[model samples]
Target: LVRTGFEHLYEVYEKIDPKGARLLEESEPYVLTYLDFPKEHAHWIRTNNLCERLNKEIKKRTRVVGVFPLKQAMLRLVGAVCINQNEEWFVATHFMDKRSLLFEELPQREACTQETIDHLLQVIDSDFKVCREVA
Candidate 1:
């Protein structure tokens, strides 16, 4: 399934952005996995936060000067940020740590509760409507 998704993305990326497709091809497989992640799971790893954090780091480094003497300075700053984020994530504790607490503390709910399900469905429907309107 994952391989098929990557194949699909490789095809789409080649069509829409040949340069990006080439870059993707040159990247490690793990680095390119986000592009092929399922749409439902995409929201979990929203790229906006990643972009914003990178931009923040770049802006911080660039604020010392109005402009860089050459593009190398900017590239070096952003490259350092990418490397730092990669290392930081490797050392970070993740969701599994909270699993025991969640399993023990979660409120028990009846599976046959139609009212709860209907209310949740209504909430989702309203959110969809609002999203469509905003879009």
Candidate 2:
């Protein structure tokens, strides 16, 4: 239904701004990614608050530092911030209510036979050889 509405809106938007419509059309695939996930999860996935908050935090921290003397120093600061944020999320309440429709689990893997194992080993050996040659 949302897709249909967007398609209709696109038609209207195209008449007003062909170039803008073309850009939107190009980005449509990415914009509608939430549709692929469970409807209950769409709200969380579609919202930009999480990303915006993280970016704001990083900007706020960087502003205090003024200038980083070394690339490694900047990296270490950003890495530490990320690690701290990760720990907070780990201890916090669930982002999405567990009782809501759960995401579909991935299918179980097939048991690997000897032939399959041999083929995988052969592929790994070929990749290793290519990497060695490149180095």
Candidate 3:
């Protein structure tokens, strides 16, 4: 059986299918990029079900009308459905709770200045160089 995690599983696949394994290794950065997101947001980020469900709702509503006399009428119905869907789950209990999502405001910072911009660029350049060396 494949062992329980990414590295172990990758090692096994690498032995069995070197070409496929190389592709995965190349994609490893993107495949695992979700890990860089806040854990709480991972579920929503990793799946398109929410969007699919929203589209399904829109289609269901539009299908009922069969046809609209004006494009605006259809748009209005879709807009309302979007608003309702947004409100239905955009709640503290369901999700979209800023605190739970780690959306707290940052501590106030000094006003931006040209000097700070240059310093930030230098830090970024140095970090990028370090990463290039490691790679």
TM-score of every model? 0.38, 0.56, 0.47
Clashing pairs in 2: none
In model 2, state the lDDT of residue 91: 75
Error of 2 at 93 (Å): 4.7
Which residue segments of model 2 deviate by more than 4 Å? Answer: 70-72, 90-93, 96-135
For model 1, residues 33-130, the per-residue Cα lDDT tens digits are 66444434455465667668777877877797668888998788778878987777667675124344344344443344666555655655566567
lDDT of candidate 1 at residue 124, scale 0 to 100: 50
lDDT of 3 by residue, 1-135 (tens): 111244544555676578987887788778776555556675677887889999999999999999899999998999999999988877637564466546464343335666766565565556656766797
Task: Kindly give the stretch of ten consecutive residues in candidate 2 with the minimal lDDT sum.
Answer: 101-110
Candidate achieving the largest lDDT: 2
User: For candidate 2, what is the lDDT?
Assistant: 0.72
lDDT of 2 at 8: 55
- Model 2 Cα shift for residue 34 (angstroms): 0.9
Candidate 3 has its poorest 10 consecutive residues by lDDT at 1-10
User: lDDT (0-100) at residue 35 of candidate 2?
Assistant: 65
Model 3 residue runs over 4 Å out of place are 1-36, 103-135
Q: Rate the local accuracy (lDDT) of all candidates.
A: 0.62, 0.72, 0.70
**Total clashing pairs in model 1:** 0
